[model samples]
Target: MSTDGASVHFSELVNRNRRTLARLEGSRSLLLRRRDGEDLVLTTASRAEQDRTVVSAATRMLLAMARREPGSMELLLDLLPDAFPWVRFLPETDLHAFAVELVDTMRAADSVGNNASVAQLLVEWQHTAEVHSDPELLAALTTDHGEDYGPVPDPREVA
Candidate 1:
């Protein structure tokens, strides 16, 4: 029943459900691997709730530390390059901005018990750094094309 780190194929859930359920007894969760879709984590309701609580607390503590101790923000800024090597491509000012936005987004996402936004934010910032790393792309993006475009459409309407 100790199936930590073991992955169960998606079909196993239907064909060998008892075995999979048994595996969850020893471990807090199980990995469900799928061929045509994203993998999933299977865990008890209580365990999932516990994880959400822990993430929320950790994010809150990080934000509090960053605000209470000025040095904590500096420390996070210093560690960002190591955590995200692509961050090095960003200018110093942009790096600081990214860190601040990242921390805020993390806290917000944790509060909602959904980490998708955090992942999205990281991907977006990484792409930004990638763009900045290429001088031609950066210049192209910054260039002002004075040509008049039509009025912007409402996002809600587009949706």
Candidate 2:
């Protein structure tokens, strides 16, 4: 695949969160689908033989950095050219643009933290952006469409 093109033949995007011992940080997930739309999760970071598969650069970069640099993360642009899935949110990007727009978005997020839609939209955008990179996850995300599975117990109440 051409590394410096406006498009990639195989594309997926995802958004997810990571759960640590006591903290949950923003993260992403992606999955691929066969021609018939059968979900196939692209084996990725920490998995054996992942390099031979087509995984999202975002997922790889995040996992790689997390190993030695706990708080460091490269933006989507920092990882590769615009053809990758995570760059979908960059509506008007150029060669000179900074990678991983999270910074700017974070700044804007801080500015509008009081607005519910602003924060939610940004989270959803980032999530989809991350998920879109893998086919299986993308297929699952698209198929789910925010359905109501059931109600959840209140965490604040003691049984």
Candidate 3:
């Protein structure tokens, strides 16, 4: 099966189930695009399980390497900029912190058979880098105002 899966409209699943399944004959997965909701992936259960197993083992190995070798973590930190170009905006200390957090989060998420936390962590750190890239925003955030504005509201409530 091809790893570069085919895309199909969400309605195809209901309107032409056989055609949709046929597309999967040459593809490892199918992307079901939705207009009002998040897109979905259709793949064989075995494939999904295999993917989880591979991710879990890779994350575990990476964590073990970082823990056993003194220079492994440093090597990983050095390579982060190439993997995530936005990380260049972060200071040296923050960059190191991000790398450590990322590996740890990936391992934890893999252990639980979920990648959502890893994705969230990456997005959060990228946003931090974005703020650091903006001099004015960085200055404003770092600056301490003498007066307390008010109590911070809950994000859920604000939303």
lDDT per model, in order? Answer: 0.88, 0.42, 0.89
**Structural similarity to truth (TM-score) of each candidate:** 0.76, 0.24, 0.86
Candidate 3 at 157: error in angstroms? 10
| Deviation of model 3 at 143, angstroms | 1.6
Clashing residue pairs, candidate 1? Answer: none
**What's the candidate order when arranged by decreasing lDDT?**
3, 1, 2
Better of 2 and 3 by TM-score: 3
Clashing residue pairs found in predicted model 3: none
Task: List ranges where model 3 is wrong by over 4 Å.
Answer: 1-5, 152-159
Clashes of 2: 20
Per-residue CA lDDT of model 1 for 56-156, tens digit only, reads: 88889878878887688898888888889999999999999998998999988977779999989999999999999999999999999898698999999
The model with the greater TM-score, 1 or 3, is: 3
Model 2, residue 107: displacement in angstroms? 7.5
Total backbone clashes of model 1? 0
In model 1, which regions exceed 4 Å deviation? 1-4, 144-159
On lDDT, who's better, 1 or 3?
A: 3
Query: Please, what are the lDDT tens digits per residue for candidate 3 over residues 1-159?
Result: 234759999999989999998998788899888999988889999989998888888889878877888888888887788899999999999998998899889878887889999989999999999999999999999998888979999999996
